[model samples]
Target: MRVFAVAEIKFGELDPVSIELLNLANSIKGDGTAEAVVIGNGISKYAEELAKYADRVWKIEDSSLENYNPELYVDVLSQLFSKEKPDIVLVANSSRGSEFAPALATKLNAPVITDIVGLDTSNGIKATRYIFQGKLLVDILVKDGDTSVFTVRQGVFKEGSEVGGEVVDAGIKPSVTPKREFSQIIEPEVGEVDISQADIIVSVGRGIEDASNIELAEELADALGGVVAGSRPVIDSGWLPKDRQVGISGKTVKPKLYLALGISGAFQHIMGMKDSELIIAVNKDPEAPIFGVAQYGIVGDIFEIVPALVDKLREIKG
Candidate 1:
């Protein structure tokens, strides 16, 4: 088997999920070859970094790829894969990766799976993904296909150790005329903290009652030496900034400790923080969906429990 993992770049740096994809590819390659494919302009450093983990790195550094264009990406990858004919192609389930995986699959006449959380190749190739809004996991076998493409979910797989490999220059230039033009990248304004990188996050939801109650969560987060985040409801209600939002439509985080205060555990919200190392949910409703995935559950009102928790933490610290 020959596996190829695509690298994703964000703000001129290699996205962390790219490494996760490489790790997954290496794990399943067994006696076969595991390679990485990177497309960008002047991304030699990224390619070099990937070479440490993959058996080989196919670096396609072209001026035309300075900015991401779905059409151009599909065209370039399709041309390459048509000739390479890799047995499996792995892409991150990120915004850009999801956009191009299906197009590339169509070009290669291969089956495409999105948001895959697990894979097994012992018998044939089986991929596991969530169905019914993440309420259930369904395994689908890739039958009757020589090539398969999968967009892997982030934070599902463990990072693997690096094995030195060689970096090969693909030297493919763009030939497709894209209907869309590249524009300047628009980045959201950064707040006092970047929740995605936080070690501990105390998140709020509609159960927070009002904007003023957000201060309670913030105090608890401060006491625990963490940061404050929120679900879409809290962000939409202006209780927190857009950068603090955690959900499917917001930022995905994998903090060491995630304290979901008053979050009802909607599928969208769970998608963002389900990968946390330790999840502790506090809600008055014992049957809230958040408890389904939480490691620790506290069925109580946040308005009353948060103040006590903050006081306890401060006492422990002092």
Candidate 2:
């Protein structure tokens, strides 16, 4: 058994999703070698960093492949796989991974799986992913061929912590021209605090209603010595900046304590913060999916409940 894990990098740093993929590959490799494939300009150092976890690292560096042109990436990787085929390939379930994996699988004529939360390696490769807003877990198996491609969800598995593994320079350059050219990357304005770094996060959802009501949640967060965050709905309504949003498309936060106010739990949102140590959800709907993973649930109006809780906390602190 041999595993080939693709690594993703952003802003000159390797994304944690890549490390998680290595960890998953290690878990599933029963006495098999786990190798890593990293692509991009100036990614040789990252290959060395990944050497700790992977048995060997395949560094694919090209001037044109610097900024992620999907066509070029697919063409280049397909050429590499033709010469060195592995039993299993793992990719991160990120924007680049989602876009690249399906096309690569098509080129390789292999089966593809996305957003896998669990893996059952006992009987072939059984992957588990959620359906219906995280309410159900569906397990899928690949029976088509010896090679299978997977796009793993972020923050689901812990990153591998080993170092000093060997590095294999793949040194293959395909003569492929892309129809699309690389462009500049636009960055969002930096906020006072990054929610991903916050230990205690108080996140609001549609239940907050009016934009003015956000202050109530903010006050509660202040009293708790934490920061304010929101679900996609709150950010979509412009009550909070995009940086304060927590979800799959947003930021993934594994805070020490997470307080959800007025947000119904969707799988996309849950995927970001499900690894949080303690989750407290407040919603009027008792059947809200947020309550399922929450350690504590409050079924009530956020308007009435948040202020009361804030006042009580202030009094206790006084």
Candidate 3:
């Protein structure tokens, strides 16, 4: 198999999902070539870093490609793939990837399997992706000897061992005129805490009852030396800021310890924090879906359990 993985760059640095894409490619490539393709204004450093894992790194740098343009990305990648004719093209299922993968597939006349969470190569290529808002998992099969593009979900694959490779400059330039012009990037306002980076997170959900009741979760988070976050419901209710929301629609997090309080564990919420090292869910309903993914489960009312847990943690601190 000949595989080509696209490396995504954000804020002048390589996106972490780029490494995950490389890892996925390397795992399935076997003895075949696993190449990394990076396109941006100044991505030489990222290309060099990717060379440690990929069989070859193709760096496409140009001043016109400083920011992400869907048309330009599709144009450049379509041209490059036309020359290379890779059997498999791997892309991260990020904001940018979601925009261009389908268009690139159309240009290449290949099948595109998006948001794939699992893959089986023993019997051809069978990819697993969620359907109906993650209510079910469906397997998509690709015929042998066929070219295809796959957008892999983030945090699904582990990082592969680094094997040194060579870096080459891909001199392909985009000929397509972008329909849109590059403008200033409007960054989101920084909140009191970035839950994505928090080591320990205490997250609440609709089960939290009311906005005023959020203090219980806050106190518990404080006692545990963690940051407070919430599910979409709590955020929508104005109890927590958008930055503190954890779900498919919000932020993905992989904290060392994730304590879900009063969370019912919708699939969207599970998708965001399922990669956490340890998950502990506390909800009164034993059948709550959140407990399915949690390492530890407590079927009790948060109003009663949170205060007890906070007191216990404070006693331990003393």
Candidate 4:
């Protein structure tokens, strides 16, 4: 059995999340071998690096692909899968990977395992995932042919040694570019430290209320000397930027001190952030699910509670 892992290449280097997936894929090694696909304008040359973690490195190049076009990439990747006939296809659960994996699975009529933590092929390709905000681990068997599409969560695996990254050519052909109706690819302008790896995160949720109320969370974050983040609704409502949103839909952050203000934890939201070192939830509702994973729980209104906490924290720090 052979596995196809998608290579996430950026600025000529492999994305950290892709490396993490390769490590996990390598761990459950048996008769199965792991390879990766490097897709970009000039990614064929990076076969050496991809070969460090995969048995074979399939590279595709086209100047048109320099900028990501979802339609065009799906076409190219689908074509590669047609001929490769690997036992499994593994993709990183990043933005582009998430979009392509499901669509490709639909076309192949193959089973898909999304945001999965572990896998077992012994029982004909069974996989497991975290359910109820990592509160439970549910196991499910893959339903379909031997081919399965696995989109792995980004932080599931740790960085490890570069082992089977040997570069064998995939020998795949490129198809004619489809007329792209996409307006244009616009990379969002960002100038902040990546919150996903921050040592401490002070995030606000719906309980904080309107966008104007954000200052309350900001002040507390400042008092703690930590970074600020928000839930999906907060970022989608433009109270904060997309990069600032935490949980599965947004960036999965694992901070040392994760302070959630007024955010009732949702399953999709908490699965990403439940790995923090210390979780402190400040929600008035005592039964809020955020308390389930939080190391410290404060059932009180943020408006009245934060000022005192900030002042006390400052005094203690001094």
Candidate 5:
């Protein structure tokens, strides 16, 4: 059972998701050797870093790869896979990894699984992913084929993974330089809250209504000493930054305490946060799906309910 784990990094060093993959690859196995594929311009040094954690590190350096151009990066990896022919591939369920994993799966004629929370290697590398907003855990197994690739969901694996493993350099062939020039990449500015890492998160949704109403949610979050997050409408309507959106289209989280304020849990919104430990929802609609998973449910409008709750929280804190 040979595996090629794909890890990409920016700024410096492998990201948290890559470290998670390394820890996973280091322990379990399906059949063959475990190898890592890293791509960057001067990624050779980082290749040495990964070697301390992985069995082997394959390197691809192209000037065009200084920044991510999906087309160019994909072309490089595709060429490498054709030559290397590893059996299983693992990647993070990140933006690029999600976009690229299916494309690679299509190219290799193998099944692709996304947002995997657990792996059942007991039966030939089967994985478990949430279906129906984590209401059920589905076990997935890819039939024997050219290569099976997995893009893991962030925060599923345990933390405190150290970077230390063996080193093998894959001196991969360079591709034609990409003609397109990347001028400026604009990244959205977001405040600090690794919501995925937070044990408690209090998120406001469209039900909060006005921009001023958001302060109530913030007060609640502060009283709980938890980070504040929100749904798409809450963010898109300029009630909050886009970074705070918690939904299928936004960042996923796995907090120990998740408080839903005025948000009707649409399946898409629920998908991103369903991995939370304990969910508490405050919504006027008792029929809202948010109530389905909410350990504690309050059926009321945010306008009346939040202030009372805030007072209670402050009293307790005081």
Candidate 6:
């Protein structure tokens, strides 16, 4: 029951999902060992950090892999897996993971599953995945002798605490011609506040309605000494920065207080913020799904509720 977790690094730092994959591997290892593969140029620097969660960390450094190339990643990982022949392989269900996992599975002649949210080794490698746009969950089982590759959904697993482990520099630099060349990464314009790090987040959605109305949410956030964020609708409407968007397509946040305004609470949105310690939702429709996970629910028009809430907060402060 050897488990191999693929480590993904961004901007010279290990992506949070990479650690989550290692944690998931630890849970299902079942007396077997867990290891991680760190791949990229100069990424060996992170071997010590990854070793905390993995029994063994393999640093696969290569100048060509400094930037992620799906073709190159699949090629390199395939070669490594061929010799390692681990029982289970875990990768994050992120943009990079979605692209690399299936391709790697094909090369390795293994069974691959995507967007898995739960894992259970008690029943011989069974996993829970969502279907019908995340409305339903179905358990899938892999027959014996089938090497399993999984693209695990982000934010679904907790990251394990740092522990002592061994680091091994595989010293495997793969040389292969790629049809595509690595290119420059385009970054979004920076904003004043990184909502992901904020302790309290006031998130707006289509219920905010107009761009000018964002000031209302901002006022509420200011009163609470928090930051303003929004759902995809607000970002797509150009009312909020992309970094401030909260959902699977956006940033996964675990703020102490998550105040959702006018959000209908789609599962994608829930997946990101459901981990918040306290969630308060205000929407005109009482049946909005946001209320499902909310600790407090206010059924009313946000336009009317926000102003009153802001006034009370200001009064309390005075």
Q: Point to the candidate with the largest TM-score.
A: 3
Off by over 4 Å in 2: 132-135, 192-200, 216-228, 232-238, 241-254, 264-275, 282-292, 297-318
Please provide, for model 4 over 1-318, each residue's C-alpha lDDT reduced to its tens digit, 9 standing for 90 to 100.
778778786545667777676677676656667777777776765667767877667777666667666666677778887887867888887778888888888877788878887778776777888776656879988775857888887665654567755665555545656666546555446656567757788899998889999887888888888888999889888998887878866777767799999899998778778888899999999999999999999999999998898889889999
lDDT of each: 0.88, 0.84, 0.87, 0.78, 0.77, 0.86
lDDT tens digits by residue: candidate 6, 1-318: 889999888765788777888888888888888899988887756888888898999888877888989888888887777777889999988789998899999888889999887889986889888776545669998888758899987666764666578998776777688898977887645556656557899999999999999999999999999999999889999998787888767777778899999999998889779998899999999899999999999999999999999999999999
Tell me the tens digit of each residue's lDDT in model 5 across 1-318: 666778878546567667567667765654545677888787777777777667677888766677766666667778888888876788888888888788778877778889887765556768888787656668887676777788887766635345455655555655656566778766545565556667888998888889998888888888888989998888889887776778756677878899999989987788888778899999998899999878999998888887898899888878
TM-score for each prediction? 0.84, 0.79, 0.85, 0.72, 0.73, 0.84
Q: Count the backbone clashes (under 3 Å) in each candidate.
A: 0, 3, 0, 5, 8, 0
**Whole-model alpha-carbon lDDT for candidate 3:** 0.87
Give per-residue CA lDDT, model 3, range 77-96, as digits (tens): 88888788898999988888
Show pairs that collide, candidate 2.
51-165, 52-163, 52-164
Task: Write the residue-wise lDDT of candidate 2 on 144-217 in tens digits.
Answer: 48689988876666645574578877887757887888779865555467676678999999998889998998
RMSD of 4: 4.5
Worst 10 residues of 1 by lDDT: 188-197
List residue ranges in candidate 5 displaced over 4 A. 11-13, 23-34, 42-55, 61-64, 75-84, 98-141, 152-163, 190-194, 222-225, 232-238, 284-288, 297-318
Which regions of candidate 3 fall more than 4 Å away from where they truly are?
192-199, 215-227, 236-238, 241-254, 266-268, 271-275, 286-289, 307-318
- Rank by lDDT (best first): 1, 3, 6, 2, 4, 5
Error of 2 at 93 (Å): 2.3
Model 3: ten consecutive residues of lowest lDDT: 188-197
CA lDDT for candidate 5: 0.77
List the candidates ranked by TM-score, beginning with the highest.
3, 6, 1, 2, 5, 4
